[model samples]
Target: MLENWHDVNGLIGNSLIYFDRNDQQWHQSWIDTNGSSLALAGGFIGGVLTLSGTKPNTGELHEIQWRPLKLGRVEQIWRMSLDNGATWTPRFRGIYYAVDQQN
Candidate 1:
């Protein structure tokens, strides 16, 4: 299920606003679906980035660039440019999930 973006923002913001008035801990994480580290926050994973890309071939056999993000659904693109961005390929192109750790 998708996390409630508003709730996530609200609760986090509320805690921050009353930090000195409450006994709470603050931390962040950069977590991948397969449980890999992207970044560390307060000694744990807080956030992560997922990327993807697509390349269509033309008559010249060169690849076309990727598409941009739309309103509802979007893919994270990790395009491979071993040849420096002329003709390209996909490196990581799939659905990714991020896990947040709280104290």
Candidate 2:
């Protein structure tokens, strides 16, 4: 399920993103304006869910990304790398409350 898309000048648009259960991987092309569906990263098991990828337009890279332990949890982790994935800087790490559960 495609949640959203980054509409940049129409030419450089990318899908917000979603995890592909069948493939067990994410595609860079789905979110890249280039329309080149390439495997961004493979999912693995280590107690916690994980994902990684680089934004096509920004050329930013990330790895060992963590996800929520369960589907309804409010907390999540986010990281990013500016130097072509040489290093990942922790930008945001906190719990997110559901302001509108109905939505």
The Cα error of candidate 1 at residue 15, in Å, is: 25
Misplaced by over 4 Å in model 1 are: 1-71, 96-103
Candidate 1 lDDT trough over 10 residues, lowest sum = 12-21
Residue 70 CA displacement from its true place in model 1, Å: 7.5
- What is the total number of backbone clashes in candidate 1? 12
**Candidate 1 structure lDDT:** 0.31
Q: What are the candidates' C-alpha RMSDs? A: 16.7, 5.5
How much lDDT does each candidate structure score?
0.31, 0.56
- C-alpha TM-scores of all predictions: 0.24, 0.46
TM-score of 2: 0.46
lDDT of 1 by residue, 1-103 (tens): 1221123233321111111224342222223343332211121122323222222231222221223344433344444554545766664454434445772
Q: For candidate 2, lDDT tens digit of each residue in 18-76?
A: 56778777543344555643225656466454566776567776554445545555454
TM-score of model 1 vs. true structure: 0.24
- The residue pairs in collision within model 2 are 4-16
